[model samples]
Target chain A: MIIDVSDPADPRLADFVGLRDAQLRRSEDRFIAEGLKIIERAFAAGAPPRSLLLQPRWLDGVLPLLTRFPDVPVYVGTEAMIEEVSGFHVHRGALGSFDRPAEATWEALLGARRLLVCEEIVDHANIGAIMRVAAGLGWDGVLVSPGSADPLYRRAIKSSMGASLELPWRRMGGAADLARLREAGFTVVASTISPRAVDVDAFEAPEKVALLLGTEGAGLSREWLAAAGAHVRIPMTDRVDSLNVATAAAILAHSLRQRG
Target chain B: MIIDVSDPADPRLADFVGLRDAQLRRSEDRFIAEGLKIIERAFAAGAPPRSLLLQPRWLDGVLPLLTRFPDVPVYVGTEAMIEEVSGFHVHRGALGSFDRPAEATWEALLGARRLLVCEEIVDHANIGAIMRVAAGLGWDGVLVSPGSADPLYRRAIKSSMGASLELPWRRMGGAADLARLREAGFTVVASTISPRAVDVDAFEAPEKVALLLGTEGAGLSREWLAAAGAHVRIPMTDRVDSLNVATAAAILAHSLRQRG
Candidate 1:
């Protein structure tokens, strides 16, 4: 179904209305996948597309993929009209709304050997980068705390390069969730900058590991740190306070990932 | 030298005009530091302050520092006034213009053991993050290609958490500059995603290392990669295309930094 949309107020474009409004997007069930690359990744990851709003020039690029989803509406509009509907300049002139996939089940996450557990990391870019690092490094899954930014957020998905769509991840409830990982034979490792923590290079990773990363400003909560089976810190010079959470995740994830 | 300015167009505020305009800022001799922390970092790094524009409330916090630079102008104003002059909402109600520090001398950089070499990495935040990772991990200095983003750009400095101020970095003319690192006893290591590249963990870093980072979209130019003494890659699953350049820098920097 190819629809020509000239009016930005068209009700059919509801999923993309105010795309830049994070709060509004959170209240909706659909997540917008921006750019042709992310859209293709979303499709490849088996995410069902609700509809697509894109400039006519991108039609040839996405036409093959649309053949598989004959029922999904494909709205073609001028660049200005599309930007008006989204409330922002849509990058590369393509966007797709997909049904937000269900979170990975606890049973699946528990069986995993390597996992990243994030606590209150509110930055969508950080959360997305963590997911990308986790997935790229062959980590089994990610478990984000309740307060953490949604990995499915448009910006997060874009930042993750669509890794969030393909990776297995679930929302974690609270500090008590540490017990669940422990019961599943995971040694919960807390990443801290405190000198008291064991240096990451010297610490031996266990057979099953769940690395705990904290927020951007203050590190992991004392309660969360106490619950960990071990504490690991990346040694750094005193010139700076700490590494960005995403940067830290990349270093930690690469170091502790299962090696052949 | 405390001064009150209600008008955004005051002639005295020329250095602070359009702080958000990268092109305009690049043409000027001064760079803006957004937050009080970055401003303080700029001062501590021994970079002379040209001027300070901040809200009235932050006066107490920066007063101690201003005492040291008695000749430097301090302009206090409403947040709205500051935002109007900057063309953006200045973060944290504070901003500073600092004399852009000179590039590190080749003699100084030649003495360093660990270095990050960036090639045309144009994103300001990536350049900033790379600087932060290099500084935090205790790298001696950074060498960026002439086309790379300015490490002293306001957004770069903010993303770096002022690491750009603290780290010693220089710009290189072209691919011929690889010979300079070689002559300085650095084994230039090119980072790539190819399977043919040596695994980062398995590869033994040379005594003096200059790790090469490429642009955001492309990995590295053929000439640069071919010029490298060795190629190393952080082993990753094939699911994702590549890590963000800064994230890759963190993993490679920590892995290759001199260990005690």
Candidate 2:
């Protein structure tokens, strides 16, 4: 249903309020998809939209997608109203409130051949970029540690360019989960900068592999590093110590990806 | 020299005012380096420090580095005062104003073996990440198009982990510079998603290589692509359209980096 809303404080626009406030968004089960492209991606991924608030200009572009769910409300408002409600200039004046999908099951991830396991990666943008590269390179799924950033967060979704909507991922329980990956016939490899770590190029990809990435500053925790079956490091000049987590993810994902 | 300034508007603090204002900073012949780490990197790179504005709490940590530049003024102030002057919460209450070094001469870059050529990548953080990866992977230098973001910008330098301070880079006059690179015996390879582009893994690296990267939203411009001696692409599944420019740079830099 299409509903025209004039007041920024209208209770109908509650889903769109305080969009820029991360803490407020975190407590809710719903996630916001920004811009027309990501909204379309969310729709294509079969995410159910609770409501949409967009300018009249975008109505025609979004009409076709709304056909699937005739009951979901589409709140039409002015760009100024959206900025007022959301506390930020809504990108292209389009935003979709969607029920965050349930994360992939551990069984589903274990059955996959390639998986990126992130440990305490707290940056939303970094996690999003990791998901984008992981999906682009055809990795089967991803497992983020309990302390990692939410891939479904707006900034993360935007950074992933909507890959978070398509990629199969779940929040891992804890460090003990490394044993579960190994038990499922996957070689757990830690990406670290330790001097004794095997060079990425020199390290052979096992038939099934789970690449472990760590937090931005500290890298993988010592407990997580010790649990891995193998440790791999990207060779680099001593001039710099490490690559950004996402940048390292791309290079490692490309180099160690399962080949036909 | 130590100066304790109470007022944010002190003329002596002019070099540090409006540090968050990019436009104001762009027109000057100097750049701000944030945090003690980046400030140290700037010092290690031998960039002359014009002045230092930092909290008194960090005085002991910065004292050792100042011994070398005894003539440089070190202004001690409260974090609130530094924040008031810089227009942002200065990271760790440490900031340095340094003379932006001169661009590396064309002669210096032309002699390098492995070079990353950026084409209008206007995001400061993206350019910074590109520089960080290029430096980490041992690329000899970088060549940015006339329209690319300033690699010396504070955000760029911080995103690069100070690689922008150490990596030798220069802006090209225009597309005609590609010919100069070719003349220097470097293969001008464009990183494109064009269907006909050779898979990066399959393409053999030339003796000397200059890999071209494009802007964020759009890929490489046609004129630049047409002028390239070769086109290469990282093979990826069709799920995502392309990798982030910085992510692409890291993979390409690693795969095609000059090796013994």
Candidate 3:
């Protein structure tokens, strides 16, 4: 059913408002994915949208998809109403909210030989890029630290080219969760550019390895690095300091996966 | 001396105008690097700024640097004037223009054991990120194909965390450049995800190697791949496809540098 919402203040659209704050609170473990192409890919990948909001003009293109999920509501609104309701420009003409998948267990994620563990990576774009890399390089799954940005954040989902939706991922509560990963027989490898760290290539790949990446600015914290099984550094020129966290994660993921 | 001008149309600030167009035209070969931090880093790295333009209010803070380059013209203007002159908001509080460095020859770039060769990657941010990765991963320089975006583009420089200024790079004029690089004894390894390509880890480090990267969407052209000494791929899982071009380059650059 197409419900037209002329009022911007309609409580029905509350799911999409103040998303960043909602994400911080963990009250809304959901995110909006924009654009028809990405939404279609998400649906095709078996990830169903919890709800959808679209301009009347897009109904013709979206109606066919709605047929696949009869129970889900397709909220229709005027362009002006969506812009006001979204509190941002909705230039993509369509948006959909999807629930974050249930957290995958460590057993499922660490089953593969290679994986990525994002430690306190707060930026949505970086998280998205890391997901894209993880998927592109064939890493098993991603483990997000408690403070990391939600992989399902609207911007991250868009930035990942919707790969985040397709990729398997889970969040670790904190250091305790990381401890569980360590106990699970996974070799936790921390990436840092510090002199004390062995060159990344020198680190032998184990049967199960988790590549830990931190934020772009400060890199992995000492506490976290000390907790890891090994600290690895990407060999760099003296003039060049470091790679973006996402890029660093990609390199490590590619290297670890290729070790087989 | 700091010359103040309230008029936005002052001909002295021509180099700082319409930066969007300036970013696209290699013939003009001009790009803007905003913010005091990036501009200062560029200057400290020996990439001289051709001119400095700043808000008159910031004269006190920027004056010391301005004094160091007496020969370089320093144009001071009101925030409103700077915005009008540049056709964009001047949020960085300062902007500077620099002369494009002389293009490095293929031989000059390959002298180092490792280098990055970009083939038609048009996004400025990707170009910038690749440059940062190349530098951080101990690669000597970068070579761009004709169709690639200029590394000097404003956004590219910012994305690179200002490493674009510190790295040596040049644009390849034609196939002849690749031919010359081949003749110079640099092993050109093209990165791909094709079924038949050897896993990226298989390539032993040569004395001099040029890791060739292509646009993310289509990947390296068949002709380019055929011309390369070997085709290498970053192994990925069945569900995941490919990584972003810059991230992929970072992985490949790190691997090659580590091997060396």
Candidate 4:
């Protein structure tokens, strides 16, 4: 299972090609786990390894993770060759290909007391950071709008520090799912910058709450804001209009946590 | 002031040469404001305009800002030439060179009730985002360790939506300044991941606060933490060790805000 590869054109290394070329769709069956820590996280998440391309120095560190998958190919290459295969420099000289984890079900998300629903948040890093905050703060689940970025993309996973793999999340089939979540007895709160919105802290937290966020440049759309049962704004000075969506998410997640 | 420049090598245009080059120092007297919106923000800040390199298509929009500084040269170029000079694709065909605003004095920072103290948080984007959150949430001033990234760096300015130019900030001469801030009647609070730290919400918000942030990778050093009057942490599940430093700053800044 340990194969040495000097040729960058080896078909076995296809999983890493054009990773930084900006052409590959990130929603493929396999997702990349870059760097040493994430590779370990992938195995810990019970991800099925497709292959691992690394250098000789990294072989021992990866051996423990591969004990269960002795048949899985472990490709070794010089640092230069590995860089040539992957579009960018592989951090710590490791790249992992693992089958993407299955999305969590709607019924599963409904079990949590606190959840985050992203409305068209398209940046991979923001999506990943939101997941990191959601998971770290003990939020039960995350739901992404249909147009959201793939959380399994390598950069997103890296930004989340691998929390995207552990967090229970799913892409909503459509916007109507917002109403469906409300029908399930969850208070859907939309974050906005509108003047009439109540201060975030002044609004009381309910037993089951779903906090909604929006994209980077423009905030929650008119249609989405009107759909929510309540609108809350982070009180701020007039000098700056809004915080980064991810930063806003962290603030809201921390503010609205259920006290023990 | 409208000068036609076909040569990218023109000495008068040295302010913008290799703008995107990694090797260039960004702490110069003039900071770049890329994109039309930031360029307009720079003008709105009453920032002194050194020059503007923009395409002819953007001329009409920029004309209003240049009327007061008729002597400031306006270099006109094709989109291709602008990219060649700046070392990257110029976002929407505009880059402005504005004289850096002066840092705020110690007296000015102490005059405010709430302040942010950053210790070696050197990433340009994080510095910018911190400033944006600080400005948005009505925080008074910011103090950074001498090693922090220049908030006026082009990317930082752009990331802060030009709040870096508007926010009051300065670098501390030494870590002793923490004690100085405390002596000035500020409650210096250090953020950390240590489990023994008090939960952020449980801590009382003093009349005056100096929320201390740590470096990007490894957090606040031992010396700085010992100097802080209080230690607070955002309560979280044991999944991730810590949130991104900027995200942590936003949550703490929001959580510990004076309720007045």
Which rank order by TM-score, best down to worst?
A: 1, 4, 2, 3
Give the candidate order by descending DockQ.
1, 2, 4, 3
Scored against the true structure, residue A72 in model 2 reaches a CA lDDT of 94
Better of 2 and 4 by lDDT: 2
Pitting candidate 1 against candidate 4, the one with the higher TM-score is 1
Tens-digit lDDT track of model 3 for A101-131:
6766767876666678888888889999888
Worst 10 residues of 2 chain A by lDDT: A19-28
Writing each residue's lDDT as its tens digit, candidate 1 over B156-177 gives 9999999999999998989999
**Candidate achieving higher TM-score, 3 or 4:** 4
DockQ of all predictions against the true structure, Cα-based: 0.89, 0.83, 0.64, 0.79
Residue-level lDDT for A213 in candidate 2: 97
lDDT on C-alpha atoms for all candidate structures: 0.91, 0.91, 0.78, 0.88
For model 4, how does the per-residue alpha-carbon lDDT over B7-107 read when each residue is reduced to its tens digit?
A: 99999899999886523555577888988889988998999999999999888989898889999999999998988888888878988998888899999
Model 3 segments beyond 4 Å from truth?
A2-12, A18-26, A55-61, A71-84, A106-114, A258-260, B3-7, B22-25, B55-61, B71-81, B89-91, B110-113, B258-260
Model 2 ranges with Cα > 4 A deviation: A2-9, A20-27, A55-57, A76-92, B20-24, B76-84, B87-91
Show where candidate 4 strays beyond 4 Å.
A20-24, A55-57, A78-84, A88-92, B20-27, B78-80, B89-92
Docking outcome class, model 3 = medium
> C-alpha displacement of A175 in model 2, angstroms?
1.8
- A158: Cα error in model 4, Å: 1.4
Q: Could you list the chain B TM-scores for each candidate? A: 0.97, 0.96, 0.91, 0.95
Number of the predicted model whose TM-score against the real structure is largest: 1
